[model samples]
Target: MNRNKLILLTAVLLLLAGGGWFLHDSGFFQAVRSLEALRAYIAGFAPYSHLLFFLVQFLSVVFAPIPSNIVAAAGGVLFGTLPGFLITFTAVASASLVTFSLARVLGREFAGRIVSKKLSEKYQGVLRTKAPVFLTLAFLFPFFPDDILCILAGLTSLSFRSFALIVLLARPWGLLFASALGGSTLGLSPWVMVPIALVGLALFLLGMKYGNQVEETVLRRLKERRSGDTE
Candidate 1:
């Protein structure tokens, strides 16, 4: 879609999310709260609980209000440690896909308006070119707000294929972080999780370094495309 339509779509979604919040607060969407409840509600479906756990986890990530740590622990309880970690990765990957798509479809123009021109210009190139690497690091690294950064990525000119592939590669590391620290029902060590975090951090910095260069290329390509379109 063109920029104008995409912006309009973003506006609509924002409004809808606002309305959803209003309804949630007003008790109209009370069931959603129950769904978000940190209970072991997956017991009945013991055979299918693993799949169900994955779905719950994916949705939790998709929705901003639901805390991922809660879902991670739920996975540990429902699916055991190793299985829980695996399931959590699958769910997170799926949720990442949803987040990536929403940004692609509705985030492009809206993202531009939200951030500073300098930051946008500096970052847009990486988004348009090597979005996957940026996304991978963005997913693995915990400090930054992944939600906003993801929406920012969507507003740029990234191809979906690269986004999906990168997300697939990146999210497992994040799950490793989640699993080793908070998600472990079996009580994994801080030292172990620490090494995992160090690896994730290293990868994140690498992604950022490359992302800066890619951003420059993206800007050049965008400028050339605009120049061509004008001609």
Candidate 2:
């Protein structure tokens, strides 16, 4: 990495480390594990509860492994569905933009350091092709690491505008669904929920099993199509 990238990477590392330590010490991580606890914590912010929730969601995405979904669900439980979805969506979308921009500025070398080398190589095709179709699918599906992909997308030829459009369009559905679940507006009975939960679990397992293959397949097809177009 060059001097600029080096400096930025160091700053990022420090921020992540310090922030992680603070969150851990504050019991933020533990509190977020349970919806009720998370709700109580955010509620402690009182007049600033929404703001606190938004900040937590944003930081969760930037920091990773913080389970943004849980934060979104907590927003629903605290602020109700529409408000929660709005807050969660806005925070996450903003964070996505920040991560994408950070990766773009720091370049591939920086990305390789933060993300695994194997994973970086696996998705490098994203940089070569105009494949918003794949990006949309990745963002929409829970199978993919959406936060990491945001950073990867920054390495692509995509302009911030196009990337923002994709984030806005494809990202909301999942957050909305999560917020709705927490809002308890679905009103499904135990009989309905049990089967739904079972099906969701099965799908999650299948996605984990085949997600890489699916990603490779899509990237390969997009590459081929791009090659054909060039020819």
How well does each candidate superpose onto the true structure, as a TM-score?
A: 0.53, 0.81
- Give the number of the best model, judged by lDDT: 2
Q: Which candidate is the best by TM-score?
A: 2
Q: Model 1 over residues 49-105: C-alpha lDDT tens digits?
A: 676667666655545555565466556555566677888877777766666676666
Residue 163, model 1: Cα distance from true site in angstroms = 1.4
Q: Report how far residue 156 has shifted in candidate 2, in Å.
A: 2.2
TM-score of model 1 relative to the true fold?
Answer: 0.53
User: For model 1, what is the error of residue 231's alpha carbon versus the real structure, in angstroms, after optimal superposition?
Assistant: 25
Displacement of residue 214 (Cα, Å) in model 1 is 20
- lDDT tens string, model 2, 64-135? 677787788788878888899999999999989988998899887656766787777777675557548877
The alpha-carbon deviation from the true structure for residue 23 of candidate 1, after best TM-score superposition, in angstroms, is 12
RMSD of 1: 8.4
